[model samples]
Target chain A: MSILDLGKACTFSQMQLEITYKGEPAPAAKVWRRVKWQKEKVDEFKTDEEGRVELPEIMERSVMQLLPSEFVVSQAIVVTYMDEEYKIWVNSKRSPEKNSELDGSDIHLKCELTDERRLVSDYESDFLTSCEII
Target chain B: MTALDPLNAAELADDIYQVEDEFTREIFYEKYKDRFELGKDSGLSDTGIKGKTGGILLKYPHMMAVMIEGKKKTSFDGQAVFAVKGTAGLMDALTDLNAGIKNARTGGKVHQGFLDVFDSYAGKLPTLSSNIHTIHCVGHSLGGALATLTADWLKSTSGKEVKLYTFGSPRVGLEHYASKAQRSIGAGNIYRVYHKTDPVPMVPTWPFFHIPDGGEGDFLLPSGLHLKPWEFHSMKRYIKSSKGDGSQSLEWSTLRSRRPQDFLDSSVEAWLKSNSIVSFTLNSARLLSAAILWVVKKLTNLLGISVVIAGSTTFTLLDRLAMLMSKGLELAKDVSIWVTRLIKRMAQMLGIVVREGAEMTMRFIRQVFIQAHHAVSELVRQAGRTLH
Candidate 1:
């Protein structure tokens, strides 16, 4: 945690992310997630044979969202497969609400390795990623 | 495999941006073909997220970098040099505006925007050949911040000698990061060169500290009495200050001694009380910065708190700073005058109207800090706009 260390504000959320190489599931790929505001903690997981990784709801405590300033907890989900890393998710989440990344919808995404990174924008923020909302 | 001379390093930092355009790329390669070898991936490009404006999307070129290998008969023989571009385009302006603190992979916290830009291409950084014995990282402005991170990474992973040369680079990290980087990179090997009037280096102030801390090997180039931040921050202006010849040591020999430590409390107080409105000069700004740091240190020591605690990179540090200054106002008379003088000088520099005794309020002084930071961010944004 960086700015969060100074105060006691907390936010919690969880998401389901799927990894694929070409058309097949990407099993055993290491998925890394970090909340930009709470950067000290990095959540790591290994995808199952189905290429599905369940991110347990993360409850990060920080004062950044409480401030009357720009609230951006840059969310990054990168996957390492076959010694190469790919950015599956890169977003600057502007609101602290759960699932606000997808306008209050559940965090379900299908990411493809072959897909080129594209810029996607919502009212909250802009995301540069290869993942599509499922 | 030696370090690049100051002028050469500045030029490389400036020229790295040229490769972003095809025509300039040809000219760049032609100019250095005899002294260096560039690969296809040498010209680096990356995108930045831009805010949606109206109904149309605009092309936002975020960052550019160049990786050059020194050929035989050149001073950088067997050496690898990586230089990144500074602020340019609308997206870069947004990047400069993203000034939140985040955890750095190497050790401490760094600017979130700088880390994001670096991370976008960190995986793509070309690997140096085994023949390369040393890595020289160079950049100006935002590129300088990225270069600092690159030097730290190369030193940690590549196990090669790393030398960093930055011009008009902003403070990349906090005190913990600065000390850690200094110890990791070896203080003497880091060269943080800046013009006396450049506003870029003065930003992300206080808690955020520049590396090679205590200015053991830093170079402070003096400038004319009046100069704009953009002019002082330009890489061309830096090249003008440094010598082009192969000699690396003599170009900034006389400036090694001109660090922030040169301004003592007495001098700072005298200058502040003099009511000199001409405070945009880098020295005056640095003096005020030094004075503030000094006052905070003294205030903490007086309150039985260690400097380490007060210097922590916490979000409430600004609030704590104002509170401490308020307490300093009540506890010691000298501290009171120092605080008042500091607020006055800071207000003058920022062009904020503050009447007498208004500095007595913690909220008022805290607002000053916030305004100061906002001013710096605006300056960086302006730089980004004009650089494009």
Candidate 2:
């Protein structure tokens, strides 16, 4: 199991995640990102893929889990790629707000799941409890 | 009204000192001494009331003081007149000088009305019980009309004298103040003030009577000294150059504004926080997603791929995935909302219990305080008896 961390600020944008089966070469791997308030699989790639995605940028941002203490997140994000589904559970290590106005409004468009599966929609989906950072 | 239109502030100020104040105090008395006296048979009393110094109107231009002394309902001393200026509305086209609420918003006049202006002269009026002797009226535009009507009303009442001074009063009535008011007010006391810049008073309004070209109405007085206004084109002569009347201008806006500590007030801050959260997430996502879609679209065209084929394929794949996620989120949302509502009801129940408990405790504490006071008083009396 590969752990993925996609952390963000109150005003963060463009969250992405890629998935690969164990022992699969990078070229055979897929990437995902949050799109239009809904989770979507916009691209398909592996280790040998030609998409110019940078690695350090996503890691530098993975400072903490989405939720710190109360609840353990089962998975950070789950992507249904074609017939098969890819799942990654991430722990969020941040404090919960005493008051949350709404999930998407507070922190929306967070994680992006990229794989060979094209799963994003024209209309955005809300980000409420879709992913557990902690 | 003279065919020469009307005199402007600049024109009136000129040749004003020459015609009126030019004569010594003796000369002023001589000119007006004859006309003021009626025919010998008129039976008018020349009382000590006319002993007042200076031109009656100009000396106290604003009726700067209104005090009620001794009896609360006594007749007022000095003039009780209100000058209302149409600083805004259609009347703006009528006069160069505008004052009041209409002028306040336009930054042309003080916002405070004539009744409440503390900085300017205040007219003292006795309480509701007193009979008002007279109410002199002066104004330009809509204000002018209101003043004339007020004066007319005062004259018709038990009051023997009601003097009116208007500056370009618009036609008050289509046929002159309901006829009876005209007769009671009499033509003698009404002085209609006017200037060339004041296009408001003529107004094609009825009541054909007009102010004469020479300053002859009621008492000819300079509206104010416009000497510095006309001679030098400098605005400083007319308006104040200081920040606010030499620093004692205690304005509400100055005292109560959004200060830095206001953020700590919490109640107001919470709304701002909530709105920003909604705005930021929704807005940024919209722009980013649209840009991505645009890039995908442009690249698809450049690759020589059939534009429609690439567009539809990409859209279809993303659309299906979005639809599924949306449905799931909606379900979660419905559940979350229900939970929140249930929690609210539980909190209300808890609140009722807590409030009852607090009230009972407070009652017990109050009873104890009363008992302690009585016991202390009894012990003090016992000690006094033993000492005796």
Candidate 3:
């Protein structure tokens, strides 16, 4: 057995994520985060009328664990709208360093969709999977 | 209908302006035979006009004098109108630009270039006649500026009520010229139609103003439809804006209620198409390996195995080799995910940079305009002090 140091763990005390399609708010969208190993949803909520959802305080230890240096543990915030899932993966090491503070922690996602029915059509899924993860 | 009618005058002016596109005079006459009979093509080389100037004079039974022409080289003479200098070559354009209220009301000094042109047409050509019955002048862009000057000269010389109609015309004079033209022509007689975004109407920036005679008829485009600045200044766009009811016109919609992922997806598809087949195949292989590794990981966790053994071990060499392969697949999966995330982040940053750059450019333009306005005002004030 080998021991590993996964760096300092940080918690987002309070942050709001707003998602917009074009310029308008996306209401009633389901947002959730699943555990890495079990794939069990750890947090879930629906966006308000203004397309805003307040994220729960996320402790790093709950979503991250020590593995070999070469292995990475990733967490993703998934938003489901119209039976389609849009994933925003959080880098455990980078997110805490960049967004550990409450000042610039808020995220604004602007999604641009060209077709409704064929959301993940060939070519589109590759380019648009990460529309604007701000 | 009377030529004084704004809509009729604009339509007729556009039609007359279209005459320049004809290869031969016969083609023009053939086309406009019903509404107008050609009087003469002025400013041809043989006509004694030094420059390559051109203007078409059309004769109608109800309306005797109707002239439409643009600048010789610049198509509309927009550059000439902005110079605002009173040189011999640019006398008409300068006169039009400087035709203040005093000049408009009192029939002040007229440009000699315009006077010479008028005299040549009125005196030598008997068909042209000394006095026009009902003078109507029309032009677009620089042609529009020239038309304004022509209309003013006709009003002064013939003492007839001349009706002026200009499309996308720049400012003709200083404040006084605008006031005088407004009063002399009777605001109702002048019809200026301008599109909201046309840069022509905004020229000769400060102190100078567009002719204030007839109330302006503005053509505004619908919102959200992004058009280049020059497109807004185009005559074709102006004509379209004039005729359309705004409902059926091409415009970008602001609403994004449905799946907003399509735009990204399509762009990705385009990028994929633009890439080499080798790169695409490599990416596919990476993705396939990642997927396979994920499935194996799930199966290993279900089987309650904490670690997969590999390499030189006390167990069979084949079993150790299989374990090593499993460890390698896991590492590959992690690396693949890392690369995909990195690419996504880079793409997002590029988009942000582009949007911010465009916004900064617009802000800079606004700042420059404000600074230029202040600079011009200061120079004018300094000149006034020197005169005093």
TM-score of chain A of each: 0.83, 0.26, 0.53
True contacts kept of each: 0.00, 0.00, 0.00
- Model-by-model DockQ, in order: 0.01, 0.00, 0.00
**How many pairs of residues collide in each model?**
0, 44, 15
Candidate order by decreasing lDDT: 1, 3, 2
Q: Is candidate 1 or candidate 2 better by TM-score?
A: 1
Top TM-score: which candidate number? 1
Residue pairs with colliding backbones in model 1 are none
* Residue runs of model 1 more than 4 Å from their true location after superposition: A1-134, B40-63, B72-74, B89-98, B225-230, B244-262, B272-286, B299-317, B323-337, B344-359, B374-388
Please write out the lDDT profile of model 3 over residues B1-388, one tens digit for every residue: 1333333334444433322211112222333333342335421122111112222211111111233222334322211110000111221232232222223323532233333333333432222233334556666655465566666655676565566767666566544455666677666566676654344444433334467522332222332244333334434444454445442322211111111221233343344334223222212322322232343344344444422232323532123223433443345664333323322322232232223223223233233323433333333223222210
Candidate chain B TM-scores, in order: 0.76, 0.28, 0.43
lDDT per residue, candidate 1, B1-388, as tens digits?
3457676787777666555433234334545666777644323222211121110122344336766677866776878787876542212332233345667889887767677667766776777678888888898876788889888988888888888899888788876787788788887778899876676777666766788645566777765554244456666467666753323434445456444335656876687678767544445557767777777666766666432343455544456566667778888886677778877778888888777655368888888877765665555555433331
Taking all chains together, each candidate's TM-score versus the true structure is 0.60, 0.22, 0.34
Residue A32 displacement in candidate 1 (angstroms): 48
Indicate the residue-level lDDT of A132 in model 1. 82
1 or 3, greater by TM-score: 1
Instruction: List runs of model 3 lying over 4 Å from the truth.
Output: A1-134, B4-8, B15-26, B39-132, B213-224, B245-388
lDDT of each: 0.65, 0.27, 0.38
